[model samples]
Target: MSFLKKLKEKISKQTDTVTEKFKHGLEKTRNSFADKVNDLVYRYRKVDEDFFEELEEILIGADVGVSTVMELIDQLKEEVQRRNIQDPKEVQAVISEKLVGIYKGDSEFSNEINMQEDQLTVVLFVGVNGVGKTTTIGKLAHKFKSEGKSVLLAAGDTFRAGAIEQLEVWGDRVGVEVIKQGSGSDPAAVMYDAVQAAKARKVDVLLCDTAGRLQNKVNLMKELEKVKRVIEREVPGAPHEVLLVIDATTGQNGLSQAKTFREATNVTGIVLTKLDGTAKGGIVLAIRNEMDVPVKFVGLGEQMDDLQQFDPEQYVYGLFANLVETEEV
Candidate 1:
């Protein structure tokens, strides 16, 4: 069985708290592409320029991004020539092969979060407002705690109202300590407090949630830089991984946000949230194809376990799972 199907079976009995939390994500994606891709398979039976053209339209429409769609189309075209064949049945296999190839290799697909740093593994999550940054941090805390890693959360998003309380609630749910100051307070102070507490608490991982800014790019950059500087002063070259959480439903917009955040804080890896609900799961491919960053995790739902390590094979297969339409030909 596919890992995702197995994953579903494993997580299903666990209840739908996480599923319900992220149901919108999957619903958005399924409604966006699952049915549409099914419709494509229903309509096409041959490999032709017309088929490729329409297929390109479908993929691009689903927010796989332009570069990735072109790469996929080219790979599909080559596969058609390689076998000296034109059957649409072969196209499915070829598409699967091409999609899996996007992972670069098995090494690239490795999900191990190596914390070979000198001290604490600090993960600084950044993205625009509403990318589930705080929620992702909560889930990460829960994941780390499950692994026997004492985790701490920092409400670095002190600018947003209820940001501290939001993280505190997650801390309570996950059974971790969250350090924070009041709203409108400096995020750097909150992070410093969290780091100091984490050091004393001997936490394995420190997940810091930063403020989400809108239109104030200059202020955002300054604030993130300040947070980084403070952590380095206290923790010695800290902020191990600057993880950027992105909503896959945002499509190309997410990729652009990654670029901006990368410029602002040197993003080390990405955490893509809300993939289960968006048809634009293709954005994962787009980001991989276009950006210098690696996707470390994907939030399929809001459950702690839903924040799964990024697996390209599972994602690609899931995307094309409904390839064989059960409609009358």
Candidate 2:
């Protein structure tokens, strides 16, 4: 069976609500990227050098990253040559398959949160200001609460004005408690207190928010290190996951932010926010390929339940949903 058909079948087995979320969230990217690809295939009936070149441009324009686009183009050429594919329409499935391949690479990386069973799971969120870091934390808290897990929020972002209040708002909205301190207090101290509270309360999960100051790399690194040290000292093998939240609409700039945050701390995964706001959703592939970090969650929309776990198959299905539904097995 064809790859698109296989993906269609797989998605069909999943919850209809989740599949529809992916499809609707990716509407912008689909209307831009997939439409162009379809038009390109129609304009060129046969796969050839010129066809590949135009496809390359389309991928690049979709913010797939130049290096990744080049690699994908090369892979497509080889696949076409090996399969002796002449019809340009046949390459669409190949493109989707290669996209999933590039995102997954060679390993089967799990995108689920690394929760500690029978113990408190500490998830530290780090990213620049205005990247929707706090919002993602709120949504994630809601998700855990919906799953019947006890969750606590730690407001460690003391530097940013109203940061604590913002987190408190989310905490109230989600019905989760927020542990915070007065503004201008040391962030490490806040983490220390938060850890103690979590331990006393026996919370299942604690999501900590940090200040997003990137003007000085050294200060940011030091602050994060100190916060991490406090968490480690309080709970052995804690801070289970350091998630860097990046705004998907920022495109390549988001990749640069990931590099900075990755250097500041051990970023186990990423939370790409505002994905539905951008037409070039290919930034997902660029981030996975370039950063070598799995995107654990994606902010599909503004709704509280829109923060969904990252699934490559569902993502590809979202990108090509129109074609997938219309294609024959």
Candidate 3:
């Protein structure tokens, strides 16, 4: 079957438990985004230039990024013409389909984290402070540990006050060990020690938390280089993944952070946190199209089990569940 066919099947076969989770998690975005699109269908009886214009406004207003929105509108127009779609209500499913297609693009989109089957998988988290970087680490630790994988956390964010303690609190809550040293210690040194500890314990995954300070790009680049060098030296080709955590509530500002950090380091994937707290959940498409980074996970709610693996189909479905073709339609 084709990728789109498989995706639709997966979404159809998705258990109610998971579907409801996404539905509730994306309630705010649904109300803001899907509701508007549904209203557009109600206003416009036929698909025409005016319909496309209003649709563009809705997407741009949802913070989907101008470039991505333009591309989507063009592709959507072509699809509408190709399929000879007319009714405005029938265009809703086409919009969701195109959004997913844009995110997936020509290549496959893998939302899974890169794992080392034989040895340890070192994952580094980077983003500005107050973006829920630390909390994401904690939730991930919980996730891996629940999978029966041994997880170790390294407190490399030495610059931020109480950073170590905060990670420690998470470690304690999640029942994982955190390696750390005194505040003001070299962040690279902390990484070195964590590498040694992971190797000694043969941990399945080692997650490192770095300073959220992004003000000084030069210093940030140098510091990150040092940490990466230490990890690579300790374990050849280590740091299998460098995941950039972004707060969905920040909207486009989060996209700017992704651009800056991508230039600073090799950001393999994105972990979008606090999605439920934002109405501009369309930022996901902007990030994928703009930064070209696959979102690995998303924070749906504030609970421990709320950090869900990013599924593009479910995401689009959740956003448009209320607007999609229904029995009533």
Candidate maximizing TM-score: 2
- Candidate 2 TM-score over all chains jointly: 0.98
Write model 3 residue lDDT over 103-184, tens digit each, in one string: 9987678999899987999999999999999999999999999999999999999999999999999999999999999999
Q: Which is better, 1 or 3, measured by TM-score? A: 3
Backbone clash pairs for candidate 3 read none
Candidate 3: worst 10 consecutive residues by lDDT? 1-10
Ranked by TM-score from best down, the candidates are: 2, 3, 1
**Span of 10 residues, lowest total lDDT, candidate 2:** 320-329
lDDT of 2 by residue, 58-130 (tens): 9998899999999999999999999999999999999999999999998668898999989999999999999
The digit string of per-residue lDDT tens for model 1 on 1-329 reads 43334444554664455444344445565566656655665577777898889888988887778888887899888868988865665565566567768655334444556574445888888988898998899888888888778788888887777888988998899898878787888889888898899888777899999987858888999999999999988887678788889988787889888888878888878899888767667787777777846788888865568887776655654554444222112
Q: Rate the local accuracy (lDDT) of all candidates.
A: 0.75, 0.94, 0.91
**Whole-model lDDT, candidate 1?**
0.75
Point to the candidate with the largest lDDT: 2
Which whole-number lDDT from 0 to 100 does residue 136 have in model 2? 96
Descending-lDDT candidate ranking: 2, 3, 1
lDDT of 3 at 192: 96
Off by over 4 Å in 1: 1-42, 105-110, 323-329
Tell me the lDDT of model 1 at 259. 86
